[model samples]
Target: ITACYCFGALLLVVASICDLVSSIQLGQDSGAVLSRPANSSRIFYGVMFDAGSTGTRIHVYTFIQKDPEELPVLDNEMFHSIKPGLSAYADMPEMGGYTVRQLLKVAKKTVPRLEWKRTPLVLKATAGLRLLPSEKSQALLEQVQDVFDESPFFVPDDSVSIMNGTNEGILAWVTVNFLTGHLYAETRETVGILDLGGGSTQITFLPKSKKTIGSSPDDYIARIDMFNSTYELYTHRTCIKYLLCHVIHRPPYIIVLLYTPGLEWRVFKSSCLPKKFREEWSFGGLTYIVSGKPDGESYVGYKLCYQEVLKVVKDIVHQPYELKDTSVFYAFSYYFDRAVDAGLIDRTQGGMLEVRDFKKRAKEVCNKMSKYRPINPFLCMDMTYITCLLKDGFGFKENTVLQLTKKVNNVETSWALGATFNHFQNLKIHR
Candidate 1:
């Protein structure tokens, strides 16, 4: 009868988790089967849907509570994803809901029919829907609610909603910490997270110094109560895709583009891109025409690209007190992608690197565009942009080493797992 639900920025199926926690804590010696387990093992499933900007994903998590009074362990996860996220159907609310319906097929097949009525279903959306018009966003959410109501799985209150930016950072921090064993160990030591997603990027960690908390912008800090302790984490979100979108009214993608003085061209050029590269890119439902100047005999490589990227990051990103010294950071998403594409790390095993490692590779890639061109067209731009982002954007020193990973212990290093953990704590499960 354990149940939970999720659909949003990350996939989370926490229904069974909440119930399992509740049951374990409420367990007492009694003749009733509800008060004590009739058997030694109890198993349940949770269905989570991640309605992201680029895609919609599902995570069907099964957990086992070995003892009646102990915490449950995640047994397995069945993950799947579909393209063209709900945001793509901004004008077609019903179709967005239909996508949810289609993903539910996996849930139906995964969870046993005997437990279907008791299994909980939930969905949470992230930056994608958050960027949409209010009317359009609500229409899509309402349609999904209708689909949930029609499904056989247990539907909980607030089953569909948009996740705020702050929670996104906090949960991701929790996920990495949990996977790294920092959450359960005796030590408070935890690694910071640098996640660069398509729409936005986040920086989060448990601040060691009180000054770190005091100096940060009020909104950048979040208070989290977990494992019987409270932590004030330094968390913030910045629009890494600032130059990609042109909409002036959007909240997160806000940017002030600087142009060359008295340049007669209408296009905005970046040294990060290939000098000869000219193409149209689309983001947030808007298309932008961009290209690099090929004719000019200029060194528009890493050094110049670094300066240009600095314009977007400098004087903006808040430097954490701990970042100045030494700290471990697990950079993922675009960070991992670019590193693999740049030959800095193995795509499957992943590898560690210093912030300057990225810089060195960026310089090499940007200078020898022709050699790496066939591997990936954006190799130069991506490598250079990431280098600038880590060094200039976050103000990390060249020698600052980051443990870049896409997964830890087989589970993905994503915000979803941390968010799932929070779901139970938020409910205040007690015996």
Candidate 2:
């Protein structure tokens, strides 16, 4: 029995190495993400599939345990993403599974055949599936899980599901702080994270004062025991895209709109849109005709746009008291993408920006409606939304600096790493 157990643990180590070394497909064959020293005795791999609102991404991580008493050290990460998230296939369950199956090829091709049975496979869906009704989202999740079961990798029963919005923020906060070494350092000081997605946004931070948590809603405060310390994180989850649904259709259209609850006829109008712009967009398997007024040319700029979004954000968004005193944060996802689009930051390497910077860009983009490309009618609206969401919604000061980045240490600074860590954090298998 002891020999069999020892052999099983050894197999797990080799299986993990197969997945990690195999993820070197994207021109990183010569990179250090996969190379390990001769003295390293133990290695493991973790596979996580993030089904986001915009797309699905896979993160395969390899860690080496140098000492039995210490935590495993991260050695390499294999990352790849696909477009049209699982939500895009809410209606076609089998098609959604097909997308996961396609990405799974990378894993199968790389993971050694002998170790395939030992590697763990999991998928966590975000805003895309959250927006879906339970039945539809469950069907989509089941499809992906079925694909996992069909593969050679190990599939845990509680593998595929829609994550809670707050947990999403917390895990992202974990990813950034852990990568930056703040989580492991002696000082507990950690940076906050602002994640903006097409369908949703999450704000999470470790408060320096209890007043911040005391004054906020009960649900806003969450406790997490990580490593050896307990952390109380202040998190807020909001969906900007949910508000976008209202203005999805250009005003003065008499057409049936499709939604999860089924089709409903309604004329959606918003002051944020241009007065004469018509656009068609698709997200989460639904098509929307978004446009400005067909008849009138009205005033559209920062002032009016802020007020329009303020009505929806003001009372609902709880402001953290410590925000003004200490405001160190890392903003990513659509925040980085739009900042690049607006020329506020660099595309390859992200930079720092003040909350007022977004306002300045918003003014420039919103005032020049004609100069603004008709292809992205939402640029002005999106910029204005970020500005309002920060200043008016979260009560962030104008001078608050947000470090925008897409990757940290050559790995995506999203929640996937954090989720992977949570999945394979501590192991005590006898070997």
Candidate 3:
């Protein structure tokens, strides 16, 4: 009996060894499959997430092998963002935790079951959390970490990290260059990138050139400088004082605007507007007009047009709307009027309206404004206008300049956040 038992144990050991070898071979074969020559079916799955002030989005990517030597193609991609807006945290602190939970839930729902365990997840937050006070922000981050639990689950951890505004601009520049196939094999030049986001805008100037090294083909050499300005116009004290006055005085114009059609109460809740506007409108029955409960479609175009008109009026009045300076407003309004004159937006019907000649009008406005002195000279010409000037005024090809501009505008959260995850993985492997 003892001899028989020993033989059985030896057989079991042999079976285990065979299983281990099979597993290793399987892993090797999978790697080989990924390395195969160009084929449509050679894609491997990956995932990325962008947690921003407006919402969190999870994007799944499938990479297809392009060739035996070249990097795989980023094939199919899909994404979903937290509904309504991620910026809810700015007004309703209590909703922050709930919003994050909902965001995670949506991610789990969207990812395929097979990929649920293997796909890499990247979580990146911008704008909203960055604006929070340090203590409150840390607490929010802690809550996120607790929820994610730092597990190597398909979802990334909740620890909040964001690229500086300058880096955001640089990433935009790189993305545009890659997309347009304008990434030169050899050239040296400085490119300025500006990005306008829902909550903020970033400006970055990058000096770059391409150098050809033997056998390596060509490579880019780049240096970047970044600058960021908050959208909030008033100082904390001034804002508080404004809020207090608004609460006490209860401006008549606010009531009139709130109760009117084409000017929904919900406009007050817009993140683009200041907090005082939201609070005042919220209390003044503006919610009912904005909600459009009775007629869902009635407020659609009207609401949008009204918002644009209101924005123009605010510009005309020189009222401080965050990130929207008087100059920007004037440029936008002038563009809208030009659109109206050009039959883009009907001038006869005077409700909320859309402008057609927006780009042209803005350019004209900027050109005219440039003649006058200004506080920040750069404000006279935004990234778009500057690109136009480069193309038209400096004899740069429109297509080439546009290629660069698009690169500066295409900012994807996944690519930026994924680099961080890759670094962490390398550290873990070495350890």
- By TM-score, the best candidate is 1
Off by over 4 Å in 3: 1-42, 66-70, 83-87, 90-97, 105-112, 150-159, 182-192, 198-200, 205-359, 363-431
In TM-score terms, candidate 2 sits at 0.83
Root-mean-square deviation per candidate: 6.7, 6.4, 16.4
Q: Look at candidate 1 and tell me the lDDT of residue 5.
A: 27
**How would you order the candidates by lDDT, starting with the best?**
2, 1, 3
Write down the TM-score of every candidate.
0.85, 0.83, 0.44
Clashes of each: 15, 0, 6
Candidate lDDT scores, in order, read 0.71, 0.71, 0.33
lDDT of 3 by residue, 1-431 (tens): 33322222111111132221110001112121223344543334444445655466665444444322333333334555675434445445446556666565554664456545444445556555665566665565555555555433444342345544334444444433332233332342323333434322233333221111121212222243211111111111011111222222221122222234455433432211211222322432333222112233233232332443343233122111222111111111122223343333453331222122333443443343323213222222222223332223222232222111111112232234233323222221100
Candidate 2: the clashing residue pairs are none
Model 2 residue runs over 4 Å out of place are: 1-38, 240-265, 268-271, 280-290, 293-298, 425-431
lDDT (tens digit, per residue) of candidate 2 on 55-138: 898887766654343335567778889998898788999999999999988777656677677677889998778777889999
**Model 2 residue 55 lDDT?**
88
Model 2 poorest 10 in a row by lDDT: 251-260
Off by over 4 Å in 1: 1-40, 240-242, 246-266, 282-287, 428-431
